[model samples]
Target: MPVATFSLVALDCPDPEALAGFYAGLLGGEVQKYNDIWCDLRTPDGIRIGFQRAPGLRPPSWPRADDNAQQLHLDLTVSDMEAAQERALALGARPLDLDDDGGERNFRVYADPAGHPFCLCRT
Candidate 1:
């Protein structure tokens, strides 16, 4: 058997509360602030994403394996790619790659407010 079960994914950023709020807005989650250095978003699907304060953090330069690589990313599935893109942009997610072959591809990439890369995949 496995030695451990899945747990939350914690991200290091400058502002934990703000990062948690961003994810909360995008993922329909409840934001819980534990302290000045830590916050988390408990999603409707019971996925807990924690955000911790890391001052002077350098967010990854996504799509570039050299230099500062994309350490990690979150893939979110949606039914309407267009609608999801709209919402994500409105909520401060910068588009990294939206050229999905005119909707032929299954996923598109974006960078969060903290510059963390994430994808909005079509279901």
Candidate 2:
């Protein structure tokens, strides 16, 4: 028998509940109770997003602090860059000082609540 194929991405956060909530809202998914120390999000495509509570989670400093590197970044495609930026900012995404040179007419970058870098690109 072949091993079942699955894609599981784990994110370390200070609060699993809060992080799960953020992703649930952003991805339009359902948050399923997993256990005391972790939470799982069931995506529409069956992908599992796992969040583990790390009391001392130190977020990466992207576009700055050359040493600390971002583990992973989610690229989101949207219709409007400005609108998407506003929404993401409202959802706890912080702006980083990256040189877009105002050249990214179709994309912008931001950091998540946990300071993970992600981009919103024009579809």
Q: Model 2 Cα displacement at 7 (Å)?
A: 2.1
Tens-digit lDDT track of model 1 for 1-123: 999998999999999998898888889979999899999899999999999999998899978797788899999999989899999999989999988998888999999999999999999
Residue pairs of candidate 2 with colliding backbone atoms: none
Query: lDDT scores for all predictions?
Result: 0.92, 0.76
Q: What is residue 62's positional error in candidate 2, in angstroms?
A: 0.6
Candidate 2 residue lDDT tens string, 77-117: 77767777777778787887435568555567787787777
List where candidate 1 sits over 4 angstroms from the true fold. none
Error of 1 at 22 (Å): 0.8
Candidate 1 TM-score, true structure as reference: 0.97
Query: For every model shown, what is its TM-score relative to the native structure?
Result: 0.97, 0.80
